[model samples]
Target: MTQQKVALVTGGNRGIGKEIVKKLIEKDNAVIFTYRSNAKEAEDLIAEFESTGIRIKALKLDVSKIEEFESFSESINLILNEWQVTGIDSLVNNAGIGFFVPFEEATAAQFDEMLNVHFKGPFFLTQKLLSSINDNASIVNISSTATRVALPGFSVYAAMKSAMETISLYQSKELGARKIRSNSILPGPVATDFSGGAVRDIEDINSRIAQQHALGRVGLPKDIASAVAFLCSEDSAWIDGQAIEVSGGYM
Candidate 1:
C-alpha cells in the first residue's frame, strides 16, 4: 500500500487557505491546519470534510508569534503520530494578514508587523518544524504578485514577500541535501475575505481587479488552490526553488 501524504497548512480556516485544505483533502492528504482565532470557522472547515476518511486537525496559531513555534512543533509531532505519519509530507506556509500602509506613512510598528507575519514567522516556524518535515517534502510559500508589480499601498508588504522569495531559493539550495523542495506561489488579486474583502464584496474594486486579469475575471480561492495541489503532487516533484505566478495571466 502506498503511504498517504500529510500536509500542514497555516491559516486554513478561510480564503485561499481553506480552499487549499479542501483540495488537499480531496487529493487524499491528511491535513493538520491552523487558524488564528476563529474557532467557529475552524470547526466548520473540519466538519465540512468529515467522512472523507482523510483526517483533519485544526489548531489555533498566530503566525506572527514566533515564541510559540517550539510548542507548535511539539503539537505537530503529536498530530503526526496520531495520523500515523512520522513527518508531514508537505508544509504550506499560507497564514498571513494584509497591510496597506504606504512606505512613508507606514509606522515602524506596521512594518514590524508585516515582517513578523510574512517573513519572520514562516522562516522560524519552518526551522522549528524541519525535524518533523520528511525528506522530499515540499514547502509552498504563499506570496503575492505585489512582489512583481508595484502597488502604492503594498510597499512594505511586498518587500516582505520579496524576502520570502529570497528565502525560498536558500531553502531549496540547503534542503536539497534531503531532497526537499521549496517554492513560492505568487497569486494576483483574488476574491476572498482577506484585506476586508474589497475584491469579493465591493463591486467597483472587484470589477477593477477582474479587468486586470488577462482572463477577464478575478481569481477565486479554488484557482489558487488548484495550483497548490499541483505543487504538492508528484507532477511538481521535479520543480523546485521556483516562483510560480498563478494570476490568470495578469499583466
Candidate 2:
C-alpha cells in the first residue's frame, strides 16, 4: 500500500498559494497550509475540500516573525500527529506581500516588509521545519521573474526573490545528504488579486503586461500552481538547485 504524502504551503488561502493547495490535493496529497489574516478565505478553502476525505489544515501564520517559528513548529507537529504522519514530504514557501512602489519612493517600512516576507521568512521557516521534513522531500520557493527583468516598482521584492534563489541553491547543497531537493519557481505577471489586482482588474495594465509574453496573456494561479505540483512530486527527484521560469517567454 502506498502511504499518503504530506505537503506544507504558506499563504494557501488565495492567489497562487491557494491554487497550489488545490493542485496538491488533486494529486492525492494531504496538505497543511498557512494564511496571514484571511480567516474567511481559509475556512472556505477548507470547507471546499471537506468532501474529499483527505487531511487539510490551515492556520494563521505571519512569516515575517521568525521569533514565532518554534511555536509554529510545535503546531506543525500536532498537525502531523493528527494526520498520522511523522514528517511532511513537501514544503512550499509561497506566503508573501507585494510592494509596487518605485525604488526612489520606496519607504523603509515597505523595504523591510519585503525583506522579511520574501527572504527572511522562507529562510528561517525552512530551517525551523527541517526536522519535520522527511528525507528526499521537496522544497519549492516562490520567486518572481522580476529578478531577471528590471522592473521599476519591483526593486525590493525582486531583490529578495533573487536572494531566495541563491538560498535555494545552498539549501539543495546542504540538504543533499538527506536527499532533499530545493528549487525556485519564477512566475511572470499573474492576474491574481496580488498587488491589488492591477493585472486582473485593469484591462489596459493587463494588456501592457501581456504584450511582453509570447503567450499574449498574463498568467493565472493555475499556471504557476501546476509547476509547483510537478516540483513537489517524485517525478522531479533528480531536479534540484534550479530556478525554473514559467513566464510564457516573457522578457
Candidate 3:
C-alpha cells in the first residue's frame, strides 16, 4: 500500500486553515494542524474526525511567535517519530490576520503585526522546518488578492502578502535542488470569519465583493481548499514558483 502523505498546516483550527485540513484529510492525507489559542476548537476538530479511523493531531502554534519555532520543530520531530515517517510531505502557511486601514492611518504596530504573521512567520518557520520536510515536498503560502488590485484600505496587508509572494518565488528557486515546489495562492474575498466577518455576515460588504467576481459570488473556504489540495498533491508536479489566483476570476 502507498504510504499516506503527511502535511503540516498552520492556523488549521479555524477559517481557511480548518477547511484546508479537512480537504487534505478527505484526500487520504495525514495532517498535523496548528491552532493558536482556541484549544477548544482544536479539540473539537480532532474529535469531529475521530470516527474516520485516522489519527488527527493538533499542535498549538502562534505563527507570529518566532521564538517558539525551535521547540515546535522538536514537537514535529516527535510526531514524525511516532508516525514512522521521515518528514512531512507538505507545509501550508495559511495563518494570517487582516485589517482594512488606509495607508495614512495604518499604525506601525499593525504593519509589524502583518509583517510578523504574514512574512517573517512563514519565512523562518519554513526555514526551521526545512529538514522536517521531505524532498519534492510542497509549500503553499496563502496570499491575498489585495496584492493584485488596489482596495480601499488594504495597503499594508496587501504589501505583506506581496512580500510573501516574493518569498514563495525565492523558496521555489532555492529549494529546487531538493525538488521541492513552492507556490502561493491568492484568494479573493472569502466569506470567512476573517476581518471581523464583514464579508461573511454583513450583507452590503458581501454583496459588493461578490459582484466583483466573474463567478458572481465571493469565494468559499472549500474553493480555496480544493486548490491547496491540488497543489499539495502530485497532480501539480509541474507547477512551481507560481502565484495562482484562486479568486473565481475576480477583477
Candidate 4:
C-alpha cells in the first residue's frame, strides 16, 4: 500500500485555509496545520477530524514572525519522527491578511504587515523547512487575483502577492534539483473573510464581483481549496514555477 503523504498548511484554522485542510485530509494526507490564535477552533477541528481516524494536528504559529520559523521547523521534525515519515510531501502557504485602505491613506505599518505575512514569512518559513520537505514534494503559495486586476485600494496587498509569485518561480528553479516543485495560486475575489466581510457579507460588493467575473459569481473557499489540492497531488507532477489563476475568468 502507498504510504500516506504528510502536509503542513499555514493558517489552516479558518476560511480558505480550513477548506484546504479538509480537502488535503480527504486525499488521505496526514495534515499538520498552523493557527496564530483561536486555539478553540483549532482544537475543535482536531477533535472532529481525529474522530474519523484521520491524522490531523493543529499547531500554534504566527506567520508574521520570521524568527519563529526555526522553532516551527523543529516542531514539524518532531511530528514527522513520531509519524515515522521521512519528510512532508506538501507545504501550503495560505495564511494572509487584507485591507481596503486607499493608496494615499495606506500606512507604512499596514504595508509592512501585508508584506511580512504574504512574502517575507513564506520565504523564511520555506527556507527553514527545506530539509523537511520530501523529494518530489509540492509547495503551493497562495496569491491573489488583486495582483492582476489592478484593483484600487489594494496596491500594497497586490504588490506583495506579485512578489510572492516571483519568489515561487525562483523557488521552483532552485528546488528542482531535489525534485521539489513550487507554484502559486492566484485566487480572485472569494466569498471569504479576506476583506473583513466587506465582500463576503456585503451583497452589493459581492454582486459587483459576480458581474465582473465570467463565471458570474465570486469564488468560494472550496473552489480555491480544490485548486490547491490539485497542485499538491501527483496529478500536477509536470507543473511547476507557474501561477495558476483560480479567478473564474475574472478580468
Per-candidate TM-scores read 0.98, 0.98, 0.98, 0.97
Write candidate 4's Cα lDDT for 11-96 as tens digits: 99889999999999998899999999899989988987766888888899999998888888899999999888889999999998
lDDT of 1 by residue, 1-251 (tens): 67789999999999999999999998989899999999999999898867766699999999999888988888998988787777999999999999578778999899999999999999999998999999999999999999999999999999999999999999999999999999999999999988999999999999988888899999999999999989998889999999999999887
Off by over 4 Å in 2: none
RMSD of each: 0.8, 0.9, 0.8, 1.0
Error of 1 at 236 (Å): 0.6
CA shift at 52, candidate 1, in angstroms? Answer: 3.3
lDDT per residue for candidate 2 within 1-251, as digits (tens), equals 67799999999999999999999999989999999998999999999978878789998899999998999999999989887787999999999988578978989998889999999999999999999999999999999999999978899899999999999999999999999999999999999999999999999999998998998889999999999999999899999999999989896
Candidate 3: clashing pairs of residues? none
lDDT of each model, Cα atoms only? Answer: 0.93, 0.94, 0.94, 0.92
Candidate 1 whole-model C-alpha lDDT, 0 to 1: 0.93
